[model samples]
Target: MSGFGNGRDIISYVALGDSFTEGMNDPYAESTGTGQERYRGWADRLAEHLARTCGEVRYANLAVRGKLIREIVQRQVPRAVELAPDLVTLCAGGNDIIRPGGDPDATARIFEAAVRRLAATGSRIVVFTGMDTGFQPVMRHLRGKIATYNMHLRAVADEHGCDVVDLWSMRVLQDRRAWSGDRLHLSAEGHRRIALRVCELLDACPPADWRDPWPAEEPLPWRAARQDDLHWAREFLVPWIGRRLTGRSSGDGRTAKRPELERLEPARYRN
Candidate 1:
């Protein structure tokens, strides 16, 4: 458990999900571009745990904010296949359920296709999580659709022999303190809780051998925080307009245009 990553010379993880996985408004978002991760969301926190306790693991977040299952299959999932990650985490089907005038069954079909494609990889350890939608709005109709889609995800995990983390069922989601203003994304502590849970599970059924607790001098030392990694949400990871963007409106009429990033203090950039 302590020297887990050291066991594998190289370990990689790719995250595929909607906004929550992308870490829409998490106060502690890592600056992937020029900023520091600072143990922000689940992706960064999980990476840090592997680095500090287990050893080191290369991680990527291909999750988009407003991405539907169809978009993920077309855009993100392919690159994940190309990366051939040791572990892949899929947190999808949320947006598809809430899209403007969406068709839930169609989105589920796309999700099934994506999971099937990933299953073909025969990955040793694949993990998936359900969407988080437990809040005041309750989002009656969309929540129902999400339940249906998560059911499919469970089926995919069973068929492919992968692990599915029922994130929606986590206590953090059930607790009001863990969510932000909109009651959608997780707070800093919330994200940390998620990372801990995932780590516990990985440690339990670890795919590769644990890294050496005491290894010789490492090739690349973990670098200090970079200023470039600290920027306003838009500037942090925002690709060129021509590149690609998440956090798009799903047209569900529930998509708010206000900057939830406002909740995140720009002063953290003072760090």
Candidate 2:
């Protein structure tokens, strides 16, 4: 209400962005092969944490997987502003900069514009830079670009008086366990860690630690690792490339799962 990180209550919160914001990769019951699972990503988990701290809170998630920054600004930002929530978290531009020929600075510019607009509403804004992809096999080449984008993100957040989640600096995410099979979206455990991180930023409740150490790793056999890579390429990478070439998106016609700001409840998804 008064300002973020000052122990002030956040009554309403809205999330906007791409797949990361959309809560992909976190498993849920209703996901029946269409990939539009109501996976409770960090945003939802953060909302639940907020609800626990504030007794009740109104929340909405306008994030849809596979959306670029421009699409988010054109679509989700206005709706979030209309809702006029006390808190808004923006995590986008990953989809745009992930592609082979994408421009990081341009994407950051577009993203900053959206942040400026959202900040105009007097809502406490939360923004995130993309994680370091150097540890991921297929995404390592994008480390530089993602880093550039992260720098831009921090600058924009400073300019707008917005809080930053700072995903880039989260060394725990460098671990493979934080990623899903696609090596992009965060896994369930990963989402939990991120939820805790975002909650720390919001100063919501007892801050959950995201830096918990993972158990000792047993290295996979070379042959099994090769097989896993092949499977990933065939199932995830191929389809992703096909979508890009065909100019299609996973969220083409899909709308936000929780479009309207409403009271948070236990297990909202029926499926």
Candidate 3:
């Protein structure tokens, strides 16, 4: 256990990273909106759980979609330090690692600097490992790179006394249903599961178990699987590639959803 929620009061919390931490593809129940309003990923879910347990928690999420590790460290890390929160979660570097010619070692060095800086603030820090991409189609080829990065992350956590949410080992996320239509971002259910996992790590009472088995489903036929892949390539992969080639990011004009640490009104956010 990280001793996060173990009798200690977390008055303020900040999350920093990329789309994963930004809560992409997981929209709020009542809103089918776009941009900041539409996404409510795991970090938001974790914040809600914390508010329920600790009360009047100040929360800020400084994660934007399509950000790389250097961008996060250079931009969000300073803002987080200024906030001086009691708890912080950092989940960056996936975008960097997945890109062509991306170096895990170089990324780790940058990541370590950020972690070291945040650790200096005496906040309880949580870092996430990249999920095993072995279950993914084209992404499976990068499994070794991701694994190398995960190892580096574990070392960083050990060195900094940070708690790690080991996504690679979380078998629940291996299911195809856990991912969104793009197969890049997580589904709403996936975000929920992550929240439960974080709650467990922090020793807070999760509404349900993260390990609860998903309902069984029949396998897709071979032709259907191929069709789905083709659709994904057309709808998601190609555009993503074009963006990279043209130096246009999905988050080019976007800012963090919750940029400042503000008191969370449970009634306003809770489901």
| Best-fitting candidate, scored by TM-score | 3
lDDT of 1 by residue, 213-271 (tens): 22344333334223323332245234322132444453223222221111222223321
Q: Write the per-residue lDDT of candidate 2 for residues 1-271, one digit (tens) a residue.
A: 3434343444889999888887888866666676645678888888876776574589999999889889999999999989989889998899889887999999989998999899889988989878887778788899899998888988998899988888888999888889899886899889989988877766664355788888899989999999999999999999999999998998888888789999986356321
Which portions of model 1 show Cα errors greater than 4 Å? Answer: 1-7, 29-39, 124-135, 204-271
After best superposition, candidate 1 residue 162: deviation in angstroms?
1.5
- TM of each candidate vs. truth: 0.66, 0.92, 0.94
Give the per-residue lDDT of model 3 (tens digit) for 209-269.
9898889999999999999989999999999999988978888988888999988877767
Question: For candidate 1, what is the total of clashing residue pairs?
Answer: 15
Error of 3 at 84 (Å): 0.9
If the candidates were sorted by their lDDT against the true structure, best first, what order would they fall in? 3, 2, 1
The CA lDDT of each predicted structure is: 0.57, 0.84, 0.89
Query: Could you tell me the TM-score of candidate 2?
Result: 0.92
